[model samples]
Target: MNALILVADDEADMEPLFRQQFRRDIKAGRFDLVFTTSARQALRIIGDAGQHDILLLLSDINMPEMSGLDLLARAKAARPNLPIIMVTAYGDADTRRRALAGGADGLLPKPIDFPALRVEINRCLAQWGAGP
Candidate 1:
């Protein structure tokens, strides 16, 4: 099965970066990455359940319309079983604490480590029993 991953980040280059990083997995049909430039857009995807069967979400902490933390909370409330990982440049204690408190499945530091992300993704997939 191809797992859909929703990515919410304001960074313009993130889409290309993720595409390049997960090229193999994408081509293999292991994952389908969907990028949204804002939390609002992410919310739309989360809200419209009929459209996207999201298996995981990777969102940046800071955004223009709504913060990723807020997005995390909302997404979790809507889909408690959904695994959401918060990504941020600030990997400080407070940030991590807030993310955990908001029910984030994991946190990834900025300048994301693709190898580590791959492991994390696999872990989430396995936990949800949706691994390829």
Candidate 2:
């Protein structure tokens, strides 16, 4: 099965940028992209589509109703093996600790560096023995 990646962020604008940045990888059959603008929407998407192809989740730290940490906890509870990476504008030791303690597989600071994101995703996939 093709690797599936879920991007969850409240900012609608980031969706296109994520698609654009990952387009090459996507076209190369590296991943299938799924997107949601809120944690609740993400949860629904995950619940509905997660069992099939989803391999990873990328989420922003802050959102309207639910935070990324909450999303991570819920997602992990539902799918323990699904890798989750949290993105935040505020990257501090404390925040990183919380993310890690919350079960994030990785953390990224925003104004997201796509190269780094790709690298981290690759690393995570490799660690899980899920990467091509």
Candidate 3:
């Protein structure tokens, strides 16, 4: 099955960038991405989808309604096996620690290095034995 990725970020600009960066994978049918501007919207998507096909979540740390950490916590509660990668412009040891404690599987600091991000994603998939 193709991996489903849920991307939550309040920034309107990020949507296009994410789509552009992951376009190849998306076209290859390696991943199905669901993008939302808010954590609440993401949660709604998860809830409405019944059985979530989501294998991973890529979320921004700072958001209006709910933070990515909160989202990670909720997603973990809903699906403990689901892996979440936290993305942020603010990268620090404390933030990383918090994310890890909150159940994040990985972290990507912005401005994101796309090549490194791709490597990390592949590594994550390999670790989960879900890679092609």
lDDT (CA) per prediction: 0.90, 0.86, 0.84
For 1-132, candidate 1 gives per-residue lDDT tens digits of 457899999998999999999898899887799999999999989999887778889999999879999999899988888889999999999999999989997899998989988998888777767674
TM-score per candidate: 0.94, 0.89, 0.88
Q: Which ten residues in a row have the lowest lDDT in candidate 3?
A: 46-55
Candidate 3 C-alpha lDDT tens digits along 1-132:
666778899998987987899898889887777889999998886765555677678899999979989998988887787778899999999999999989888899999888977886787667667784
Provide the lDDT at 93 for model 1.
95
lDDT, candidate 3, equals 0.84
The 10 consecutive residues of candidate 1 with the worst lDDT sum are 123-132
Query: Against the true structure, candidate 2 has what lDDT?
Result: 0.86
**Number of backbone collisions per candidate, in order?**
0, 0, 0
Query: What lDDT score goes with residue 129 in model 3?
Result: 71
Q: Provide the lowest-lDDT 10-residue window in model 2.
A: 46-55
- Which stretches of model 2 miss by more than 4 angstroms? 49-51, 124-132
- How would you order the candidates by TM-score, starting with the best? 1, 2, 3
Candidate 1: list runs displaced more than 4 Å.
128-132
